[model samples]
Target: MTDVVVPATGYVIISASPDFSCPDSRRYYRDKGIMQGKTVIYGDIISAEERRAMKKGFAGKLANLVWRRDKTLFAPDESCAAVFVDLDDPRFANPEFLVSLATAGEQVRVIGKSDRNDIQDTIKVSKLGVAEVLTSEQCLTRLHDLLNEVEEIATASEHRDTRYTIDALIGSSPQIKEIRKTIRLLAEVDFPSALILGETGSGKSLVSRILHNTGLRGKHNLVEVNCSAIPDELFESELFGHVKGAFTDAKNEKTGLFEFAQEGTLFLDEVGNLSPSAQAKLLKVLEDKKLRKVGSVEEKDISVRVVAATNVDLHEAIRAGQFREDLYFRLNLLTIEIPPLRQRPEDIRDLIEYYLNQFAVLYNKGTIRFSENAIEDMTAYAWPGNIRELCNVVERAVLLTHRDEITAKDIRSALKRGRITAAERRQLTIELPPQGVSLEDVQAQVIKRVLDMFNWNKTEAARYLQISRPRLRRIIQAAGLEQNRRRP
Candidate 1:
């Protein structure tokens, strides 16, 4: 019997024989010794003519049935072991059918095509209670392979082990080595605060997590906040919370993140984005080791450690009167600066190997090996988006390219447009003439320059300009640049 473990309490046994189909029964011929589980959902149904062809020997046999079938035969209930349904199954189109499966089991997987419509349909079905959508290729292989790997990840996350160690910082470079050493030292002491500085996607958040999970307070919660995302008016309330009736919308007394993260770590991401008032308030809490809820006079003593991270230059921010100087000094006591992926080229290959194997298993594409030229091309390039960008490239290559070996062409196709150097950025800087210029002309020139810099890639241009893709497209069309360009 071909056994597949669902996230539920039992196994899903799929077979090729049509004799297993029973209109009135939910389970087929199940061998307890082989198909040992609380329940078993037979995963295929064939026509009456095919059912009549089943000989005595073929009647109860169970095996892999990877061929595309239009029907799934099973009645899911509280005792359902698993539900294996295809996207095109007529019954699958019903919301109640999916809901019943979801209510019975913890997981529902729909096997479908890898095309856009099917992918979008999978997303739509997820709202109706589908947990995961697997493409036919993913199902063809790694049915058993996925179980162990997925279980390992789930176990690690539930036990709080993944991404919470110095080893999570995957690199052999000296810079990464020094960061790990620093983290080990930080964990030995009860430091009040620490600072992490790096470019976007350079593992600053991972470093903060490691710093918290490896320390004495590892057992406690690690509350994270994106300082830039919080509104200026709600900054104080979000951090300190508020008592009931403190504001128009404060219907009930609420505990803030600081209190929730008691004796643990409060990770403040993009701290440099905090307003002057927010910065002053945060600095006070850091200095006093206590916090008073909004609209309250009583202060609660706190022992939580603060680990703040930012991609911007706080020194320059302070000089520009944007970030507070006092707050910077307070958090800069223990500092860790992560080198960009480009600076530490030694780690690129390691990262590539790690992500390749990871995504290969994740997508069920067995043993995808990158050609030497592919590795060389990726390693020599400057990864402007750092580790995050590299991951996206590798995942895309694994998901889209259907082959055992990946070539340099595949790597280059997945990688983003080349990042512009600081010198190049300066060289392309715009200047105003003595006669002055129209705002429209200046705007058009700026858009054109950014687009050209990224080799006319609209997505990259939009990101660099801090605008939406549609808006960028409109500007390009208005400037008549779209007519001249071949690619979107």
Candidate 2:
């Protein structure tokens, strides 16, 4: 006999075989009264053919199935949210077939009738991915508890996945769809190394965390290291550890990042900035999967998956002899290039809404809304700093705006006070005096104007002009306008 509950519809019982009787099972659920006022079909009144037809009829409507192993027959084509199996029955003795029935996203519970060594059998069955194991004495209460817990978890998981997962990436653009697909595919694979390349603030770090948190190594530690931030002299020691008395500061034997992330993941941020010596050491470790402490002759084997991210182009650095080609190849086994914000403007509105909601809850404030004009301006603006800049803008607007609705003026003020580039602030317009103007003269004039605007501060001027200070200096020199400095 099989008892099924079609969630939100009603409960029903179908007896599949007349020869196999389960009066105790029927009486147990009937006394519980959970299935009162539900439909019941008797196998004695219906033929075997009629039972098969009924099973096929209710296939799509069923949400969960609870079967008595001795009396119930297996319906290979039927599937449900959860399945309960009587482990004491000889017909359901094959653990492999029971596991196969569980499948992905489906729950299976094994119930034992005897107390003899059932705990050991439960442990063995759990290894095959059975969700829960219980004795028949505790079966009713445990089953009810398990169902409630599973329902709550399923609801929360759905909500969380919609908010923070790759699905929450929030874009309908082709580039974003491709990224989502790539992330899904990569999550399924067991690749050891992956490289994430993008501009600063383009969510490379977010991607790294998602990959580790959702992948097989999710349960283990995920160690992150900023290669550009570490000093060149301490790079090897910091990454590979050192023995006690290995150097002046080496008073204790230290565990390196590799050992810390053993059987897990190690994320190297800004990996393209590693020094030549550090790169060689990293390459050796990647090649051999082993490392030695600074003063120790013993080499320890590591089983760490590497995830490297860089805003700088490693290929260009390699061409300039600033990054190692071999290390690049090793880390670049699987590459995911994130498109800049400007390339996916359709996602800007969704991102703005998401951050607004996030910050509203974080700051314990009421819900905030954005004016149409504000959304228009934000969507049209070129976010050179990408999602990071947008988040800052939203945070500042939320904190500073007095009204619940943010207008374009609020966005503009936030941008101006934050980091508005000259291109975003003012459009340069040049009108020739009926006579053609020298391109160099125009360039020199613009450069002088920017320098004077920032009080002759080359660093600030370069930032406003969206160029490096060295590049700004070269432009000033080429234009022969070095003497046009404003005294502070």
Candidate 3:
């Protein structure tokens, strides 16, 4: 895909589809600010086959941008196809691109010459970005809706002076004990530098806070920096402090985390995202026990204990050269591995009870307990998002329940966002000979499942598999499934 397979001079814009926004078409126009009255140029690159079908095979145009007028046919009026591209840089592909987690039905921009909305039909797409797709008008509407919802629900969990202890961490399982023991050991030994590794939404922050609150650093400041939330340019000032007049924006002298947490703990969350330059500075600070703030020539001694947490493996990051090897070594003086919620079913009940109390007090609502079936169903769920998802689900139930109890319907509402049938879910996994039927039967079933997934749209399904539509129909017929042959 990285190879430049597209022609730069002539590109075709033949669109109108039910399925996707081709990234090949928009790879060039990701940063196109706006197009109001701008003059634009277009071009045409036609295969000999399409050239022969001009006018005769054509469909009516709905608007300037193409439309999906028919189920399975496409044609151009007069010319083979007109491709729109910005005259400024005819190579339509933009350099910026977004990385997606790869989910079906998710919209993605593509770069190619076969079809398009604007100038991209010409110059090859060189860049693309996965980004917010909302127009300015839609964004304003959504903001309005959000504002209304905020007024309807005034959810503020006020802090209590209740004693915070490691015991509040919850769970008595072996897996839970391992995490507690690690924290206890870290606190007992007074480890200066450490890392906690866990998946997103896992309670790495809770563990770090528990460690600080119950340990020697309990009395001192416990400053936390979420590396994921920090701007790249301000990392130095944010972490190491800055002197007045350091830069245009540095209007006043500021004390940084290292200075503010002088005899305390500095919790670095999502430390995996730190820039290499930032990582180097952090390594120097850990090694020398001193930090030089941005715009400050003089270094100051710091007694901050670093506790970093990341969802990614630092060793892999080192191999990719996105992280500093020395910084990894220094921060990893001690490590705590927090297991995800899916792996600890024994603690779901405890978490349910714990969060129930939290929500009751936070929302100032009467105490609500989960029904037996609700608890069982929750524990049965895989919890791919871990504790954070659980907490959100519980909070939602506590707000909506009329009685002092939660029902399965509450959990169902949140989970039913994406509903797949038992058969549909079964189709995702191939069963082995222990229970499955003959190989031919399984093959036919899987083929039917995939075809259904594409909604009996043979051409679309074939494109998904990168195969010819005619060939796919032949296979379906060969399997004695002539009914599977797509109509229109």
Best prediction by TM-score: 1
Model 3 Cα displacement at 194 (Å)?
0.9
Clashes of 1: 0
The TM-score values for the models, in the order shown, are 0.59, 0.56, 0.55
- Model 3 worst lDDT window (10 residues): 11-20
Clashes of each: 0, 0, 32
| Model 1 lDDT per residue over 1-488, tens place | 11123221111112111111232211422321112222222233333433332222132233322322333433343233334455455555577766655555433343332223353465456545553445443443333333333343323323444545778888899999999899988888989889999888788888887887788877565777777655566667768878988886566676777876787788899898888989999999999988999888899999988999998889899999999889999999899999888789999989989899877765567778888888887776556677887887887777668889988777666654434335434333355789998888789878876775575778988998999999999888888876654221
lDDT of each: 0.64, 0.64, 0.56
How good is model 3 by TM-score? Answer: 0.55
What's the true lDDT of residue 444 in model 1?
82
Worst 10 residues of 2 by lDDT: 9-18
Task: Score residue 391 of candidate 2 by CA lDDT.
Answer: 90
Which of the numbered candidates is closest to the native, going by highest lDDT?
Answer: 1
- C-alpha lDDT of residue 336 in model 2: 92
Give the higher-TM-score candidate: 2 or 3. 2
Error of 3 at 303 (Å): 0.6
